[model samples]
Target: MLLTTVLIADFEKAGRATCQRLLQLEKKIKVVGEARCGLEAMTAAAKLKPRVLLLDPSGVEGEGVYLVSTILEKSPKTRIILLSERASDADILDALSQGALGYLAKPALASYLTKAVRAVAAGEAWVPRRMVGRLIDQLAPGQA
Candidate 1:
């Protein structure tokens, strides 16, 4: 199996460590870089060109949406996976609107996150099924 290179950008040491540990536990996933802030993430994303970027919004100093779009702009092929504790409809929708390919609510199970990373790396969206209908409703021309 081809390994999926993942760049984890979390502000706190513990957060980064936990994510790195979980990802390392997955044989097919390899963590290639770690960043503590938005600038570092952009730099790492540009240099490493990881297949997936796991970003924790709270860890990034500036606006999370900007980071998402900027990262996409810099690395067009990189699929961004947002990790956050905020599970509100608006938060998830906002991240998706800004070019994030996946959103895993904080406290997410390790198995689910691993699967999400693989799915997103393969060019698939990794949003929960429950959010699909609402997302469609919100994005549909007449509904929004």
Candidate 2:
């Protein structure tokens, strides 16, 4: 029964709180840290070294990309999941391209979020159903 440590990063306090509350219901999921900004998120990831990072890039003044890149560069073991309102096909593909292991929409149900965290922690990619083909195309071309 190993618990999965998670860091919640969002622009709004309520966003962080909502995720924290929802995730706490799962015994195996622990909310280790919360961040209200990209800088805080990066610092928390470095210091806390949580197993999963649930990042919402919306409030980061477009630095979300850089934040993700640096966090991964600094903490390669921290698997990042983008939990954002930006749900366009391009956004999904871009996030995955930028090294996120999972992407969930803003209104995601608690079950989906928890399931995604577990799946990503277990080394699997998670994405909305519609984006699966795009994710595959994005990842596979590089392997060829």
Q: Number of the top candidate by lDDT?
A: 1
lDDT of 2: 0.85
Off by over 4 Å in 2: 139-144
Question: How far off is residue 107 in model 2, in Å?
Answer: 0.8
Clashing pairs in 1: none
Q: Per-residue alpha-carbon lDDT of model 2 for 28-110, expressed as tens digits? A: 99999898888899999999999999999888886566577788987889999998766678876777777888888778746
Q: Candidate 2: minimum summed lDDT over ten consecutive residues — where? A: 135-144
* Model 2, TM vs. native: 0.91
TM-score, cand. 1 vs. native? 0.91
All candidates: TM-score: 0.91, 0.91
lDDT accuracy of residue 120 in candidate 1: 96
lDDT of each: 0.87, 0.85
